[model samples]
Target: MQIATMTIDEIRVGIREQKFTAQEVVKALFQRIKKVEPEIGGYITLCEEDALQQAIIVDEKIKAGEKLGKLAGVPVAVKDNICTDGIRTTCASKMLEDFIPPYDATVVKKLKAEDAIIIGKTNMDEFAMGSSNENSAFKIVKNPWDTKRVPGGSSGGSAAVVAAGMAPLSLGSDTGGSIRQPAAFCGVVGLKPTYGLVSRFGLIAFASSLDQIGPLTRTVKDCALSLEVLQGNDPMDGTSVKEVKTKSYLDGLEEGVKGYKIGIPKGFLQKGLNEEIAKAIEDSIEKFKELGAIVEEIDLPITDAELSAYYIISSAEASSNLARFDGVRYGYRTEDFQKLDELMEKTRTEAFGGEVKRRIMLGTYALSSGYYDAYYNKAQKLREKIRQQYQEIFKTYDLIITPTTPSLPFLCGEKVNDPMEMYLGDIYTININLAKLPALSMPCGFSKEGLPIGIQLIGGEYTEDKILKAAFALEEELKLSTIIPEGKEEI
Candidate 1:
């Protein structure tokens, strides 16, 4: 059987029925990685021995007639930024090239407890800074849809692995639009849960307030299943909310979108959006309407300021969070320097990529004595205003709809020179982070060039189930069959 082509649910059934052993699935994934990693560059490190060992244990448990967790035996790729005990967690930056955490991140712990096998650590942009994955200190992750185009930033590796059929499910951290943007580029589903909804205990800090850990999968149902395992609060993380009961995400996968109110934010589909992407989103809305959803046009007054505030706030927090990587305690260390100051300067300069350095400088400048109130303080106030705007809109709407990205995946090196233009690609997604709302992006259609386009569904805080239900409804109404990457055979 072609294990790589199967969904997470299908794999679980295969294991339960003894149609395929977990070891065989893990072996197939490794073989797939060996074949595709050269072109995709999805992983920074592959934990072959560890993953296979765990899979064997799962196979034994299944043979012993022991009941398993929801994700038992499912192989998942983890983003490099999330700490994995005993594995190097570099965040795709040279500064932490040799750093290995002594403990797993909270999400990693949860996945392990559920018997999910960690396949490997995936590549990402340095310190989660760039819009495209090209900023990684290691290598860029290419979009599975078109090898010449880029997979979106930070979570690019995680998204590409699932899209390319190298892994069934993966974990990705979304600060700004990392998870959703890459999912859009790779033609997969990515969920960025509400702030504090998932524990962040050992996720290497990017933009602390904006970052939330979620899943990247081929289907919305797989994302929901992964979230179920990773969603509870952690005592180790103060920002994590207390345990909240969540609905069975898989229970309503086939439920149609009857009596649901989907809001279309008019400002989201204005000028600058590509005609093809706009049409795709409009078609998706029509499909939702046909599925018994009530579509309404709404306005978010602070949409314009969202990107600006996101940059200001994120950069400032990143600068502060990154201060600990000075070579004295952890991460990459320089042996050539004599003095402490020289060592610190040399290590950072050589270790960090240009984008990471740029943000650090921008953030340091923003938080400086005279500029704090002008940039950081003002951005915080605007963030509150944006959150308030979302709160008001959610009162009348169940979910907000938008084109996940303004344009299809661009050719490699196309916008690498222009950081501002690259940042603008996330216009539709960054606001959800700013407002602390939950959002999901799913493949909706293809462009004229055969590249994939995505449609986003944004929901109120803690309304992830409602959001996924809407996505599932649209998925059926549109009948969007999964598309494999060109030139690849389904294993």
Candidate 2:
């Protein structure tokens, strides 16, 4: 059997039963990566030696009769934006191309504690700025379903790697649909936990308030298993939720969505949506009804304002958070400037990519002397209103369903030059981040060209388990969860 095709739970059981050594599992995946990575381009850095060494240690521990962590011997990849000490954590940007963290991110620490083998760091849009993987300064990640199409970003690599069977699971950071959108494009499962549900300490920040770390996996169960390991309070992150969760994400996952009240936003289905996708979402809602869910049509009028508010707020935060990289600290430095100010300007100009520069400029303008209140402050108020709207809806509905993305994966260069079109890719997803709620994307069907299409499920704050359970029920009903991209062998 190909270990790369196994789910996290299956891998855990196999390792415990001595069906295969951890070393064998890691090696098999690495071989798979070597074969498909040339076309997929899912990974930016591969930790071959370190991963194999860790596998050996895991095998030794098993032989010594020691207890293993939940994900022991499971091979996984991490988005390059999350810090991994001594490993190059380039956010697919030239600025941090040579930068290596001295300490692991909090989530990475938790992953190690669970003994999940880190096989590599996956590619992503530069600084997690753009919606298309084409924005990565290093290389663009290709959708595994069709190599010519772009994988959704900024967590594109994480999704592609999982879908390509290069890794059964991977960690991805979602600032604005980065995790879920890519999962939709690649036809996998990605969960963007309620803001602060997963600690942000050591995740290279794009937009502090909006950024969240989540998991991308082939199945909802694997996604939930990873989330259980990922969630919890971290003293390192002040924004992390302090209240301890009472239950495991995997618990009651098989429970059907009976008696649950689900809402379908009338606004999400309107304009600019693909007919095929609209039909799929409508079919999914009907399936939920068949499963005994009380489905209703709800109106969230503030949906139109989400894109503008998201851009302003996220950009403002990105400007402040990125100021730390101004040549004086770490990351890329400029040799052309003799003056300090010139050095800062030159370094940023040379190191940062076009999209990064555009965002920084927009953010700086929004936060500048006269524009702060007009732009940034106004955006903040609008964000609160948007949050309240969702809060009100959730009071009556247990979950809200929408299309994960408005359209299927586009051709690689089709929208790379058109920033507005690229920004529109996250239209259905950005507002959830603004509301600080939990949401997920799971493949609902394939397109005419066989590319994957996803349906999204949103839940109230800290209701990750509820959303996962609902997704699990619907996933079972649909029976279309296990998908391997065209070229990948089932083995």
Candidate 3:
């Protein structure tokens, strides 16, 4: 039946009708993984036994006539950064490659409660540092659409799994476009809910203030379905907001886009963006207009400073969050160290990838005594300014639209040498984290070379519903279902 090709909605319907058991679905997924994973490198750890056990339990519950959650019996891929109890939580770094948590992360707990079978832990850029999956201590995750190109990162593995139909849904963490950028490159839907909207207790720290966990899925409705299970507050996480009662995210899928005002930031489309990307975004904006959305040009001057502030603030927080991985508590340990300092240095140097080390050094330098105020402190102030700018823009517009990335997916190893250039590629996305807003990335068009182009829909804080509705409308209008890479026969 090609169960992997089914969307979450189709799977849910199929499960209700007893067309297939959860165990069968999971077994099919593992078979697909065994067939494709070696070439794509999407997963780091595959829990075949545990996954089958959970699937069996879900199947039993259905047979017993027990109520099931929206995600019941569905298989979803999890980004390695999000902790799953008893599963090795390696944020694609050698440091925690063998560290297993004693408890589930907030999201994992919620998914389990919903009877979702977690299939495996996917690969990622080490500690969510780089935009390409090449930085992963594990193998690089290639784009399912074009193996020669990257899938984007550090959520590349999650995005690849969905694009390749290995999983209909997956979880990804975005500190600075970790979710959206990859979704864009892989031609899938990736959403980053507002800061504090989803609990972060189980998500390994990257940039504390900017990091968020959200879904990467085949469709906007699938993303919404996953969000229904993952959203809400956990007392364990101080940043989590109180649970909010809302209608089903899928209820509004057919709602037309009348009376909606979508703001297009002129600054985003201008300067530094590739010609094809700019045209693609404009074409998408026109599609929204055709769908009855009132498109207007808006200005967001603070976007120019987004990348700078993101790097400074994110690096500072990373330096702090990563300090615990010094070979003492968890993760890799050095056997030949004569002193504590030697042990710490050797372990860190050996365990961390180059990009992780670069960010740590940048973070340490930003937080150092004399430079703190100039770099870290100033960056904070700039963050507030960006937030204020977004707030003001949202007051007049229901959502702001822009290109998810300035260009299509670059070939693997294309931008690896120049760190700064690679960072610049995330220009349109990093600011949303700084502004603490909700945003989604969805496929808008395909480049001439066949690479996917994504358009981002940014909304005010806690405006996930609005963003999803807009994305859903666009998805219907575009009718852009992604195609699996042609080289999978060789995999």
TM-score of each: 0.98, 0.98, 0.97
Residue-level lDDT tens digits of model 1 in 1-491: 66556788888878888889899989988888888889999999999999999999999899889878778889989999999999889999988888899999989989998888999999998988877899999899999888999998779999999988899999999999999999998899999999998999999898999999999988877887888888877899898888677557777767777988888877776788999999898889988888899999887642556788899999999999988888888788888999999989988888888999889998999999999999999999999888998899899889998988888999999999998888888788888898899999999999988888988999999999899888887776666536677777654
- Ranking under TM-score, best-scoring first? 2, 1, 3
Error of 2 at 258 (Å): 0.3
Scored by lDDT, the top model is 2
RMSD of 3: 1.6
Between which residue pairs do clashes occur in model 2? none
Q: Rate the local accuracy (lDDT) of all candidates.
A: 0.88, 0.91, 0.88
* Candidate 1, superposed: residue stretches over 4 Å from native: none
As for TM-score, the candidate ahead, 1 or 2, is 2
Model 1 TM-score, 2 decimals? 0.98
* Model 1 poorest ten-residue lDDT run: 474-483
